[model samples]
Target: MGIIRTTVFTGLLTTSTAAAYLAARNPVISPLAATDPIWTSSVFKRHNPSRNPATQDVCIRRIPLDKIRPELLQREGDLALEFCRGVWSGWGFAVQRKYLDLKYRGPETAKQLWTNEELAQSTYDRGTCIADHFEVVEKTPTAITVRCGDSPRKQDPRPSDGLFVISATVDKQREEVELRLKTCLFSSEGTIQGIKGPMPAWMEEMHQWYARIWSETGSWRLLK
Candidate 1:
């Protein structure tokens, strides 16, 4: 078949031109941040012996949190959550979520357009992913660890993804906040394309494409 569509984060797989398409028009923020996005993965040989190295996906976007539009959040909302939400709220991922919501029988009740408070509550309260399609594994002022298996689709997938952590760390020295999106896939019985081991290079490239979108979306929201 064609490229195997995968990852709640890999929405760009179907639409490869999304970045180029969106790039034509100017967004609110430019240059993203002082640093470029970083993508890395490891199997955690000691801790996660059964984990697949191909399963872990980490996307990092470093931007100045101080430069955010104050009007976007005034109440007791976490900026970091908003940053991560923006990554999910990006066009490609949003479309995939909505499509799944329409196709699935048990569509989640979470709002597609989230408010700052809603995100904060979802994370800090450790609410079920259905409340919002995110499961809070851990939370701090600067970082929040979320799992992909929050909803039915993810909980039951072709090959499931694992823990996703988003961090918006403030640094006085660097004068920018680092927004990192990390996901380590948990082992399951399923495998894509009869390959029980690592995925194809195209799949890896697709992962990198979407990872960059995480920062692009975050940057757009930072200015919007």
Candidate 2:
């Protein structure tokens, strides 16, 4: 309850503090339920810069679960349904609000995870290095469970503790992949480092670049 409490509202609950708080409160509620939120936000540092190097924006996304997927069945597709009901609905709005101050292609990275298999596999690999072991626990018609390989070490209190369940739903009717990613936002104290700051002029230039991309592309469209 408290876990879901923080992600939905932007207060003092940072990623660095969330994991431990959730772990302490874990026995009562399922991690999947904890992921649900109407609103979610995050701040991330952009990696490489075309122009302005130092950019930080808090992005937010708000979406209704019903409008999100037309084909998600309620009874059979529980994991996928729960995740969409919880996270994905919020993720789009988070992106819209610029909560995750990402480097280049942050939104692209998220889109790729859902639509690209090779990229998803690479993500799985990266999680392995961060944790001791990772495994896909269950695979449903449209959902799967991924358990972390290693538990957060008691002494290593950086804010990572819990399992994740992701789902892949194929709209057989539409021939589209409806991939859903659901995970606990832990307090990793994890910060993206080594970004070379650009001049103020460069920031303006990069903004134009992103604006142009958003204006032109269907996925990154900027509404007038």
TM-score for each candidate, following the candidate numbering: 0.58, 0.24
Give one digit per residue, the lDDT tens place, for model 1 in 1-224: 01221242256435777666433321222212324221222312322334444344555555564666676445434667666666555543555556655654243454432443443334443433533455555566665666553352344432444556666655658876556665555444343343233545576556655656655555455553
Worst window of 10 by summed lDDT in candidate 1: 25-34
lDDT score for residue 144 of model 1: 61
User: Which portions of model 1 show Cα errors greater than 4 Å?
Assistant: 1-54, 70-77, 105-124, 130-134, 149-159, 188-198
On residues 1-224, what C-alpha lDDT tens digit does candidate 2 reach at each position?
A: 32343344333234476334322322122222323431121111111111112322211122233334443444565424344233322322335324322322343343322222232233232222211223343445554444432332232323333234445454556554344344432333344345432225465344333322221121111111
Q: What is the C-alpha lDDT of each candidate?
A: 0.49, 0.32
Per-candidate RMSD, Å: 9.7, 17.6
* Deviation from native of the Cα of residue 180 in model 2, angstroms: 2.1
User: lDDT score, residue 146, model 1?
Assistant: 62
